[model samples]
Target: MKANQKATILLIYTGGTIGMIKDADTGALKAFNFKKLIKGIPELKLLDCNIETVSFEKPIDSSNMQISDWQKTAEIIEKNYTNFDGFVVLHGSDTMSYSASALSFMFENLNKPIVFTGSQLPIGDLRTDAKENLITAIQIASLQEKGKPVIQEVSLYFEYKLYRGNRTTKISAEHFNAFTSPNFPELVESGVHLNVNNEVLLKENVSKKLKVNTNFDDNVFILKLFPGINKTILHTLLHTPNLKGVVLETYGSGNAPMENWFIDEIESAIKRGIHIINVTQCSGGTVLMGAYETSTRLKEIGLISGKNITTEAAITKLMYLLGQNVANSVFKTIFETSLRGEMND
Candidate 1:
């Protein structure tokens, strides 16, 4: 690598469909050495970038993903904070949103690309989509103009679409287009030409230094309001011992039942200093806590609106923000506000 060379990209493979291969001995799927990745994709040599791989010591299935794994990914990024211009995470699609959302909140004031990508099929298959997904992700991570990153936010690149990581949710199991941003537009779409919707991107904090937050409070719960829900179960969840925060899934426009017991329970939780975030159950709308009389009680009881955020984003954002030991009064304000380009301003 010369002093005046192209941008460097760090490809972090944290276990996913993209790295799987047929083990000759066992005939079982296993993750292969990333050193052989280029041999399978010769087109990578045509790109004007220096790409490097950093695979996990022990590849984990998406089902085995843990909070500790998130910490490991963060530490890696922190260690290479200045060496690489951007990062591409080849991850299991099952938990990609959670990982992406966590990273979005963890890396405050970040100005580099962190694109997460995975395929529906294993790379060893003849018709595997992994090669296209991985190749383009590398290209996107290395994208720059005027000597600055064109994509300065965490994103998910899959099935020819690039979405804001924190704002997306997986909505399919068998389809190549598995994820979507319920309320936001696609950030970038891959085609004959890569068209970037710059207007939808999060503006980088040009004045603030990059701040990485490692601490995360995992003492959080989610309760989706539905008809016929038992009040006992509801109280148990809200009244859990030493609960810190909650992500409440409410009806359209943040409407909840006006039942006296429900209202009273919410009020009591607020009195106990538990942050209650009211997010809509619907995929594509913002929660308006006071829009209707039905939701007035929620607002009066101090429920916060999670405007246009997916369930995956809400839970992780709450964990990230709550871990910072911020005051209770601040949690409501911060949860509803757009952080890490997760929601609209």
Candidate 2:
């Protein structure tokens, strides 16, 4: 890399509020053509990077996103990984955390930045956060340290803060600040200057070749625990056909009822080869199993501890590992471990 060499960035628009505009006569929001992206954001021309854009022909809202969509996004990145210096994914904020987490697992040994961003208001709105988000996300992607990509992992940029993708969750619907990584500090922050906490940024793995994994098993479900959950209802979910994994969103610090029936239900499921992961319901804090009597049974029954992992990451990780056909003996250990900077130590 040379000073005069311009970095090439690939901008992928998968459709969301960021790609919508109000029709003048009809006044209804519709997808904007990516061909007019440069014209719409004239300031992009001033940037040092050469930009190329691709889009989904039928822009599906974030709510409609599926595993196939995640596969498609990964495919695009895989196909163009060599050509682009960095990548930016324009996605709807509603499910951005899930998408980002999924991609983090899909792209193994990623050495380039994949910044995911979207807006609460449409890009054409009078008051929009789209431009700022888009601009900074690209800048973060194009960042180079000693001629190498600075941020070398999947990340989400929203409301002037950049967070590790798998660590973030959408916490609001109406606010510009819609995403937060409650359990993790931000990788970067934008204010008077783009303040990057470089020490925490994921270091690039230059030795490993980039691998795109799209074989995700969706035979997993989230069972969020609540007070007074019926035994019958719990049994029914635990017996869902073809269920290979479960993200059990447990109470504080991964504690759950110490009742014999509850512990037996989980033990039965685990014995039947169903992976039971205990994740804390709270936004922050690690799951310290056996820290209390309520959680000791879960540990004794061999439930995997999702320590400080977001539910989005836990579920996606379950699917990824299951798709890989990990052995049952090692599944619990792998699920509890951080595969892609998705969880803390």
Candidate 3:
């Protein structure tokens, strides 16, 4: 990222709708051969940066995205960290938020742009939005100022907006604007010009080397509470073998049913060394643990408050923290803390 030096961008394609095209023989959708990617989109030659392409040996639908895939993605970035100026990750939109959030936690002290983007329609379709999304994502990743990358954290760009990857949630299935960052503001927006909200971006850190942590423990579950959530269901989830963490999707303001059994069950789980984090079911608000009488018991019984964190981020953060084997005494404090700008202060 030196002045007058052209940026080099690594495009990591991990499979998604954006990489699909209709097979000539059967007309069925299939992954586009990335080796021919440039041939298909010669427009890439027009960019000011040098672009290199890499693909997952076997591309997977985002619904099938797993912990191992996340590790692989992180490893890819780790392997090329020194050689590349920026990275653009092509991921399926279905579980893009989870993968993005996981990568944000996996890489500590990240100092380059890792822009994740995918299209709602296949690139072959005449009405596809894939071209614009891919084009703008690379543009954002290539942005530089004072001989340094402008974006230094993981982010998601869809439709026309760029958001902190961990702060995003897929909000629509049919529309082009499929993701939203409810609690945090967008980092960049695309239109007639690419407008970067510089103040909202994560400040760059140059002193520390990029550290990749792939030890994600999947011994966690999200227990979304609802009316008539019986004791049997609660017991089953709480007593699951090797259950290290639980992202409890509680009622408004992190409230739960004010019954003796509910309190006893939650307290028992906490005593058994189970980490339960209370996140609001609502999409756009912080969890106020002691704002109501019903939530007062949870706050007193040692549940961590996930202030305004999306469920996708909460679950992945739980896995990342658990895998770190953080001390039991400090688990609550650490869970509540804003790591990688996933939550507000």
By how many angstroms RMSD does model 3 differ from the true structure? 0.8
lDDT of 2 by residue, 1-345 (tens): 565678889999998999999898988999988999999999889888999999987889999999999999999999999998899999999999999999999989999999999999989889999999999999889988677888899999999999999999999998999999989899999999889998888875699898888999999999999999988999999999999999999999999988889888899999999998999999888899999999988998899999999999999999999998999988888877788888887
Give Cα distance to truth, residue 224, candidate 3, Å: 0.7
Count clashing residue pairs per candidate: 0, 0, 0
lDDT of 1 by residue, 67-139 (tens): 7898899889889978998899989999999989998999888899999999888887778889889888888
Q: What are the C-alpha RMSDs, in order, of all predicted structures?
A: 1.8, 0.9, 0.8
Give residue 158's lDDT in candidate 3 (0 to 100).
98
- Candidate 2, lDDT over the whole model: 0.92
What are the models' TM-scores? 0.96, 0.98, 0.99
Find the 10 residues in a row with the least total lDDT in model 1.
Answer: 1-10
Worst 10 residues of 3 by lDDT: 203-212
